[model samples]
Target: MTRIAACQLAPVPDGLAANAELTADAVREALAQGADVVILPQLVTTGGVLEDAEQARAVAVASGHGVFAAWAAACTARQGSVVVGGFCEAGDDGQLYNSAAVVDATGLRAVYRCAHLWDRERVVFAAGSAPPPVVDTAHGRIGVLVNYDLRFPEWTRTAALAGADLLAVPVAWPAAQPGEGGGPDGQLVAAATARLERVAVACADRSGPGWTAGSCIVSASGQLLAAAGPGRSAAWADVDPEASRDKLVAGSSDLWLDRRPELYDRLTAPRSTSG
Candidate 1:
């Protein structure tokens, strides 16, 4: 059983130094609770929503930023422990990106830039062309995804196909409006995605104005293992990453073997105006 902790935090807007210490402390606290995988909210190093491109670029840091090093240091407290969290990245290409980094005691393993931009994000950060990366860690194979990336099933499927045992999502989900209906709940999406891909999912969400503080962990079987309700908190769960390797959903019904990829050509095709 691999213990996972999804931390819900309220990051100070544009406060890099403050958020760095806050997130690092959260990681240490999660580690002390015997968590093998510790996940933090999106843009944890710079808060959830930035005012504009200028503000975002002001706080953007490179992948080699000391904030990731702090997370790496926290992982050293627990053997084989891994941490996944989001940050505003100053890409080497001289562009800003909403990105997430996978770090462990060995240091930063992979950094995935968010491919699908959310509202106002497209104006601030460049969308990543690369697919979500699956990092092989001591505990398990972990995949990284940022906030809006979770809304795209194809993107999450891409991660699962890459043999990710667990999907670590760092998000700053918007709060549901009054009378809202038919909208995707972050927790519900996590559960459905786990069921569809047969992979465990952990989502760490941030809290503040216009944000939902819903952090949760789901099992490979689509069960809601644990949840951190409103406010800053941490959700804990013990899941079996190995269970994802079993593609058998039922007798002779393999999730992977039963795929009809040949018919999925349209999934990558250009959008059509009609039909």
Candidate 2:
């Protein structure tokens, strides 16, 4: 079993210094509390929403090295723990991408660029071209996702098919939206996905003016193992990736082995509006 910590952070807009300090502090606290891995919210270095694209682009950091190196060093000194968190990334082509980096005592291991953008994010940040990578760690084989990516089932399935045991999601979900005004919280979506993929999920959501602070950890059976509310909060869970190997929901109903991929060809075909 891996001890997981989901940290709910409130990042100040454009305040990289304050945000970084808070994130580092949270990691230390979680480790002290016996957590083997810690997950933080998306765009944590620069808050969720941005006023100006140029200013947002300025706060983007490299995938690894620098601040990440410092975090790795701290982890190494503390007997080695895994840290997964999101940040604004300065891409090579002079654009910005919402990126999540994985670090441990061995230093930076993997980075997942957010492939899906929501609302005004499309105007400010470029959608990543690469898919989320399943990375190996001391705790387990971890996959990663950003805020809007959770709405896509295909993406999560891709991660599961890639042999990921845990999915680390960093999100900045709004408090309320236009259509579905009142219903289950954002974490429910995560819970359902965890059940469908049969993998543990750790979601770290932000808490601020326009965001929801529902941070949670779900078990492979789609159970809500731990959760937290607004402000700076942390949720803990003990997960075993091996539990997801049992794909049988009932007698002869295997999850992966019973797939009908031949009939789902239309899912990948181009759509037409005139139909």
Per TM-score, the best of the predicted structures is 1
Candidate 1 matches the true fold with a TM-score of 0.95
Summarize candidate 2's per-residue lDDT along 80-143 as a digit string, tens digits.
5888999998887888888899988788898888998888888778898787889887788899
**Candidate 2 lDDT:** 0.83
**Cα distance off (Å), candidate 1, residue 194:** 0.8
Residue 204's lDDT in candidate 1: 93
Top candidate by lDDT: 1
Question: Can you tell me which runs of candidate 2 are displaced by over 4 Å?
Answer: 77-80, 177-184
RMSD of 2: 2.2
For each candidate, the alpha-carbon lDDT, in order, equals 0.89, 0.83
- TM for every model, in the order presented, reads 0.95, 0.92
